[model samples]
Target chain A: MRALVLLRAFSRAKAHTLLFSSHCARRHCHAPAKRERAKGPRILGPDLPDIWRSPPLDSTHPPPPLIDANQEINPTIIDGNSIAEEIRSRTAEEVHQMKDAVKKIPGLAVILVGQRRDSQTYVRYKIKACHEVGIRSLTAELPEDCTEDEVVDSVSRFNEDPSVHGILVQLPLPQHMNEERILGAISLEKDVDGFHPLNVGNLAMRGREPLFIPCAARACIELLTRTGIELMGKHVAVIGRSKVVGLPTTLLLQRHHATVSSVHAFTKNPQDITRQADIVISAAGVANLVRGSWLKRGAVVIDVGTNPVEDPSSEHGYHLTGDVCFKEAVKVASAITPVPGGVGPVTIAMLLSNTLDSAKQIYGLNC
Target chain B: MRALVLLRAFSRAKAHTLLFSSHCARRHCHAPAKRERAKGPRILGPDLPDIWRSPPLDSTHPPPPLIDANQEINPTIIDGNSIAEEIRSRTAEEVHQMKDAVKKIPGLAVILVGQRRDSQTYVRYKIKACHEVGIRSLTAELPEDCTEDEVVDSVSRFNEDPSVHGILVQLPLPQHMNEERILGAISLEKDVDGFHPLNVGNLAMRGREPLFIPCAARACIELLTRTGIELMGKHVAVIGRSKVVGLPTTLLLQRHHATVSSVHAFTKNPQDITRQADIVISAAGVANLVRGSWLKRGAVVIDVGTNPVEDPSSEHGYHLTGDVCFKEAVKVASAITPVPGGVGPVTIAMLLSNTLDSAKQIYGLNC
Candidate 1:
């Protein structure tokens, strides 16, 4: 068990605030610009080759030029995709280090039902991202005819499995199936999705803290925090108050000292109120719903909507667009998250981050 | 059961909104004021109660001169004893009716530990108020040696008993107990205190309604609202963020369209931020804490603190004071709640209100 002492170093990355210090087995790291790491072979995402096979640099097939931390995160320049890739690479390094030390790999199970093409594609993207973060990926593609009992059984299996730290049952699970019941059934401990009532309650309250990692909401705040944006005393407008995204997102934003207004469909003259917001986050899933003038000038925009609209030019006959009218919004808003490239990648990164949290909690690192 | 119901109705001089609307064996359709209730019982608070509780005035206690509908709600002077009496009278008719129908009567359990003279006095006053409201009061005077588990187990037993709807385990439960654990252990369905996470979450989230009810925080807002002071679009400064009162209170104000800034001990320059607010509620439990100069002129203040100050002038050797410097604030501030008299009585009224909620939930009125 003394070998476990070596495993503790990778966990210390969270505490490395001022110094980029880490005790890696190998002189390698996996972020955008890999930094000094603990002693171990470098790990890659599921899509990438093992550390032994892949060379340090792919001079022939070069990856996209990484964005400098100093530069503003650009949406049009595959920002979401890139941020996600960077996160996965970092996770890969940690996973690889653990594997090198003879530890069972951390895993995430994604249970998808029915063929909403967008949802299916999302699962695929998540699977690819999971490997990048060094967390083993398990995908159970259930058919549209699947029973509630079957889904329940699978979640139970994942719950019992020591290897799996997170189990995500993709949203919009067929209308006939009870969504709340299914969501509530997920054990609070393993609910990395952070949609459980206890987690939401903890997030809403002052002293109580959620044990489950709030992936999407946390990602939005983390992106802003990492970007050095000061949130204290900022008035943030969160449009669309869904249980999954908008509501919890508002709570998290409020936690960081941002005065938040959650506007739902019923809110009269929502745009008039939105214009007052210093920060606009539209997770309504309505394509181009947030108009140009609806935004407050210089406001930071985070578009969580992944609504696919019909586009003749696209191969799939549809193009994914966010709730915000990006073209016009970008002109006025100081910064905004892109449709495909913004919040999407950050969600996966946070998921992996949560899995590691579960690993840490299981191992009793700090507690 | 039918005989008991009739007895309960007979006990009260007249029935109020909730009981009259829900449990009344027969409708008072002939009455003019009652005729307007074609939509059945108005579940909304205060407005319905004002219309329903019309007593035939005697020479001694004549209906205080006919005032307009929009006048302030302090029927009695700002003194705590007078306000507590006035509130009791408002619910007098309903109290009579409740006693008529159910011989067992509405009950509230007040659990107290040790002789924290202040807490003991508070509990004693609450028990006295219950009797005034025609409610059966139950007190569990536990020894200072009572373990956390013992307290929790007692609360659990009371929660299972159908008779006890509102259970208040007095705050500052002896040092040995974990407060959050004990509070969390109280069933949300029976939690009239509204300290349960579910209620807090519901209160914080936009559009979602809480089942148990919010009391102390709601009472603070109700005081301001009753005084014809609208919180909508007003900047409210909450100078605390405790789970019980401050945090939930701020969120409730925010939900009502008040731009709220919650400050605490961690907050630097709290008065600077509070000065910008139109309404100030200091629940930090610090006596004479909020100086007059810190307040914005014409700011409506609701002092939710029940801090005890050493005052040898009184027989008890201590006097209950508020978070505000009342003498200083009264000159600058347009309206302020006096420490001992203001929020204390309203808290009991809200407890009664929550019992009605518990009964309503059990009755499935909302569902």
Candidate 2:
């Protein structure tokens, strides 16, 4: 399984190289103009690849240009999509083995309350990933006006189900509902989201192992580790302290022996702090929050922000953007993760991986 | 109760001023000679007050000089003993009121499993503080070679005891014992030490409050807040990542909206990071780990280290030292806490506070 994953990763890297060559071909046409702009303060928006952009039909904003045309330096793009794919493939193989050995497959149960488009899309992606890995997926779709007890009932039912190895309650339950109370109802063993206080506490302490880590935080570390970015003894500036990502990422980074500086809204002169870091992880959910000046030269950038910016050209009428000013950061940073294909896909892969681990624990099987 | 505590604090502050004046008179005797040493790198040992030092009976190390001879600045000496006394007085008044309003009092049960001198001293202090605050105290002294189940049995008994509002398992439990398993057995409600993962997890997350925060971390925050030092938006360098003090202190600082940089042994240039902070909290346990150059002038210093250094003149054959080089820091920092008299006393006070809060919660009392 390890060899298979490595083989997939190697092929993916080669594919990434070929794709970059095509981007280089497109960049040559505007190389002269780009070099002039690169001399001054970079005011350019993210130069996304054509493949990542949609057709301009009744578009409000003009389509962003292709890759930065700077010939002097091209950063090694940390391909999170490729890494997530490798993880999913490994999880699939393990699920297949587990099923053959015990005639038992991993099961994930999701309770998504309300009809929030973003939440629905997230749940759909999760279910699809579960099915791809041969994991049984169960979902309870509650009305927008559902009571707190209704959500608890779904969680309780899933907790009692022997077949359900993982339970996730999609976040941002209606403002009227008590999110913490509902989440607290989930059984510790089946909390694949790893939102339980016990799990989080375990993660924070040294010599203690959390049963599961939150998917996005796990994704951040996985991307760095798999990409051979050394964390130990390195200075990391984690921007934002949201419970789901920033806070957990800080705890996990400390566990890995990285000296972390947590930057938030209350931070004064955040740029100076970020510039001092060996690595900068921006999860602030603010568009273009981290500019070129905010990072040190050769710093590794992990963009976890998935802010939605209006784009009528896209089918969803919006495009996902990252916290980093991509065009500006790519010039200063040695390596960087792109918005839509970066931490987002890897986060989903982590969810599947966690679900498989949960099932394996219950079945007493080791992959 | 509040007024009484304030009055006691005012008296204590006045007494501290009187004590410092006599030290100033002593400093005048060696003013000319000490002035020469201050111009250099300031390689002086802690200038402890005569009251804090024991008589030099079989003295090996020379008696250290008095406060820094530099007359240009005199930092506010954050007398934690005075602050802790204020808290204890408040708790005592509240406990007294509780006894009047109801016939019950807060109870704290401590389980000491080993003969480690430090643990024993800490447990003794806790018991003494509880008694001083009018809270009931119980203790179980187990042998060093006691079985894990034996310790758990004690915890279980306390967990079920209606009179026991708080349970504390004195740390560094024998090498053979599984500490996490034993601590996990304690009832969450009675976990006054707040070592439980749930409490830690809650503390790490925004919009969530832990039932109890670790005592030393609480002491760090209380010392700062009571001193009128604003935390919101301030840059704080937390040296060390120990679960008991450093890690929790970092989390709590973040919750208070402070941008915190966690510097550990792995950090390449901890001094540079510490120098950049408005506040520096040293809990690294290394004696004088933070030097004068590591601090910014006018920065607030909270030294939580209580490291024991050999001192033949002292009765105990050792003396408590802080992580900061006091004589050096005193010249630079705007405010600083001393070693033995600083965080140590307040930690015990917080444990008492937590026990009182736990009992109040259980009894459904507002106070």
Candidate 3:
């Protein structure tokens, strides 16, 4: 058991590609000969083995039961996308069942600073989702030049306002504003992003859940479990160690009884280690990073990356792809979440779920 | 990896014990019969394996470098008795450090609801420890019939008082009063006991530290580290999964990178796992549960149990013996902490440290 960990001690995350049979990829593209292999710092270059070498082409062990690019059998696809649809319909029904007809609505205040396009899209979608769910969403788009006091003032207003059940500041606030301070200012009850270290810490510990669930982290688990994937007694491999993904995912999985090994950018020979997993979740942004060759047969893959790759055929000048190299993986894997459908929709579903939770908490109502 | 994790699914809090011949218990006690061996539950039992059952018990697979418990050495014979006196002198110097002369002495408001004799003793020691640390210690003892609101009122008063930087309400409040209500009311910033779910959650997370440290938890780490015991890359087996001890202790050690395992009452074979550890920290209230036969050669054992065992020979009529069978474990363990002196003094020391940290946070000085 210890021998495998030691063997990978000097290995690093590699860009894996599958030598797809002629039936796949359709052309003699001969996927870019795996390049940019990570290697330890050495005075002399190209010292020994290639750093960017593609993962082994040899199929060694019996393949894991997984959902790769080829295996498009995500449970949600067959269930009529019913889980999310139920949530949306429930939100509609509940909103219609309000107390006053013009009752103290679920109030969510979002603070956005600067013009980061991604943050803007997230905020926009959140507000739209809130409105769709009959939540009164308030947007506070402050200028990049705004001071820390300005952000704190906005948070203070939401904290006192009985109308507001949640306060979420769009992340990546201007450099001048202390993210911790701005988040902390949002009273614990109203801090809906749950990015407050206290919230994050609370989420990690036993005996309690977060006041406002971090949607992305929760979504990763939801996608995995809803597909008849039980967490207990499973060997799961998670890539990425960001506070948002890798670390939180590990804590959540442990809570559910999965013996997990974490691999990040600093991990050695991550592919070989990952190949041993019953489930693989990649949140790292490296594009087409996970190829069929890297996966254990039938291993479930949930790609959280939303990287955009250049594709002239798309009107946007580029196309969004997942961390997985889909075509080759589909032939060997069992189940896989598509880039745009699997986790993305679940993220929104959880956000709505958390907002509903926030409303229930504030109103002393049971859900 | 999958099979071991499943067939040997174990908690990571306190794991890895007795893997060598040194684990043999002393002549002072009888070993548990082969038929009565301690085994963790088949599923999530205590994380430690009975290391004594493993092979190559010597230099080939040594005890963790940080611990190096000389199972053959008697701590009393090795000057461990002087640790208390040495601690006393060091604590005295800290009080006289002169940095707090002009400071508004940080105060801890300790509230006791019921008159349990043991509770009284614990509180008294804590108050005295605070005094020795040059901090103001306020005592508020309420009647057993006190209402929940009354308890909350005292906590509110302490929270409002600028002088109080820490608050601890003695445990086992009367059954009539809601413990959660009283605990939740103590300001999170001054919760020194760290029983509040918020505090517990914070400490459970990786890359997160509680604002006000948990005393016993911190003490375990401090005591081990002060004695030159490092946890990095070692495996620690923790017995007990109580909120106060087993669970938090596991989280604390994991943060230190000691592959930890947790064991609770439901564990099928507890000692079988403990035998594999480089270190064993047992907080289970069970008496003499861990014995020499279950230990690996030279394993360090930190017995956190303060269980009062009947002993007519002692002045108190009841004497404290650790969860471990001390007499037998003493012969096998490289270093073993005594029941009364080992953990007790350090727990007080850490409480003082937390009070000091609370003061720094409150005053924003010398942090």
Candidate 4:
């Protein structure tokens, strides 16, 4: 087992080096080719290299190389982890400055109800993240069968607490509890999750600004903008219509002056629509739902889906996967974000950013 | 001049008759033809009819007929005026019931600033509409140079007036006035225009309901549903992103399970996108921006634009026209709404409907 782990790590490192070198070469030698190729059919031809046409590998085997040596094109890998770290470091600096100037730091209060292991793990990550940025954190844990009033009371306490600059009620609250009622109890000023209808409405409207934007949606845009992708006048196809990610992302894209098309389960010929977009964002939550054939050549792909599929070789007997088949997309896209290290890290960074913003507003510090 | 007036009126009546008879015949004879043609290219062939090929007419000439004798297809004209009358009559009956049961009728307060002739005309029409439906109306006329505080005070007064179930602040308030601040001051319950961020947010979210939907957006949906058009899974292209019509309409279409593409000023190749939609809704506020070639052969068209263009032959020296070229679209679309009598009338009726609903909610009468 130890030898196998070493082999897998070595293979991954080798794959990264190959992809990076190829990506660099393509940028220098094929800039004009990329644009000309984008106008033609993106369907892979039968002459695909043996390595590119290989079938999916099992967890027992070492992961295949991300780029085939003989392949003519390879996408630029968007390193979300590095970007997230950059944001966190910047936020930490701000927090340190606030502490030095005013002897205060941002505070985030999280209310977690029920014992779902996933929810507990998520809360733990959030708390740890707060500590990393020098922000104070508090948690309210309730029994699985807690009453709606109990949850509301916890929110009320946080709402009234001046130290709690941001209040987040962990989602999927016990089935018996009314999610809307409890969420609505959070003060609008401290709604760091940006789930409040007023915040959403303001975000959707032109010339209006929301106090806070939803984290995942903000993460998607941050990834693109940070990568120097200009959104203005660009055509974007967002696959999914969930309130948490897809809907807000579409609205945000429109705010950036991108022509947006929302494709969901009911959409007929979704691939055809997606193939025409210059940017494709998939939040459908269906593992490997989007294929290379669904994308336009040289398109920028942002996969927000994070589904856990069973994998016995893993410690937890499962592994996280995204909506797109990464193997197929990397060959066709101009730039692509990988699953585990992509949107998830950036989303957490946005949460920290929002909390910091709330603290600044409360403390009357423009910075 | 009198003879020309009679000639124009007679010509219009004859055109309506021709369109109606042809539409009915095509519905019976070309039901299958419509479905088959939808898959083929929609461009007009070289053998186009002479009447359809005529250039734009001057005000002096009699308006051209809507259908040619040899034309193979004619769309079913959506009669917005008649549909609006039906809704208005229904609202009047509900108002009568409320008066009989509780001795109360819905009251609307309009705050009009400045002396813009168009704004004054719109306010006059609204007041007349309220009276037609047995709604009590009040107006506060302010000068063009009124202070922001004066506008806020007007909104505050209406907000406090329990008798006023709905409050409408006429749009395009003086350049010096802040529109957002004044509109935000209106009580949420009395925001009949549904411009409140909270209402818009709720409308955009799944499993959430807004206190009121914007009138024009609601009107667009009413026209489609009442005309027996199925929105579920349909591909809809919404041209424009205005807060009043386009934005809300696009949001509403998503709520109805339609896959929506928002085609805006920044959209590349807007015609290509519009041509692929199963339903095309133009609210760009640009007169005659959409031509016949921009439509699918059997697509449903909802023209929400109401742009006023100079017409010396008219009493007002200007006539209201929609974003679509009516003469060209009639031959391509499966169903269409005409300008002047299309979404304009229906939008006002929706306002009345929203006001009536507000009164019912406040009066504790669900019916």
Question: Of the candidates shown, which would achieve the greatest TM-score relative to the real structure?
Answer: 4
Q: For model 3, what is the alpha-carbon lDDT of residue B162?
A: 76
Q: What is the TM-score of chain B alone in each candidate?
A: 0.76, 0.80, 0.77, 0.80
The DockQ of each candidate is: 0.08, 0.20, 0.04, 0.19
CAPRI verdict on model 1?
Answer: incorrect
TM-score of 1: 0.66
> How big is the positional error of residue A84 in model 1, measured in Å on the Cα after superposition?
3.2
Write the residue-wise lDDT of candidate 3 on B1-367 in tens digits. Answer: 3224322322211121112122221111111111101111111112231111111111222233333443335443223335544555554554455255644666889999888988999999988877776778999999888787888999989887878878999876765655545776777667777766545544554423455446666667766765777676565778765556766677677656565545544333445446656789988777787877767777888888898878899888898877888888887777788878777777776666566656654544343
The order by descending DockQ is 2, 4, 1, 3
For residues B41-121, could you state the per-residue lDDT of candidate 4 as single tens digits? Answer: 211111111111111121232212223435667588999999899889989999999999999999999999999998999
**lDDT per residue (tens digit) for residues B160-216 in model 2:** 788998999998777666666677777766788988776787678654556678888
Model 4 spans with C-alpha error above 4 angstroms: A1-71, B1-72
Residues forming the 10-long window of minimal summed lDDT in candidate 4 chain A = A30-39
Candidate 1 chain B lDDT trough over 10 residues, lowest sum? B29-38
DockQ category of candidate 3: incorrect
Tens-digit lDDT string for candidate 3 (A290-363): 77766677677777778788899998788888777777666555677777666766677666666665665445
Look at candidate 1 and tell me the lDDT of residue A248. Answer: 77
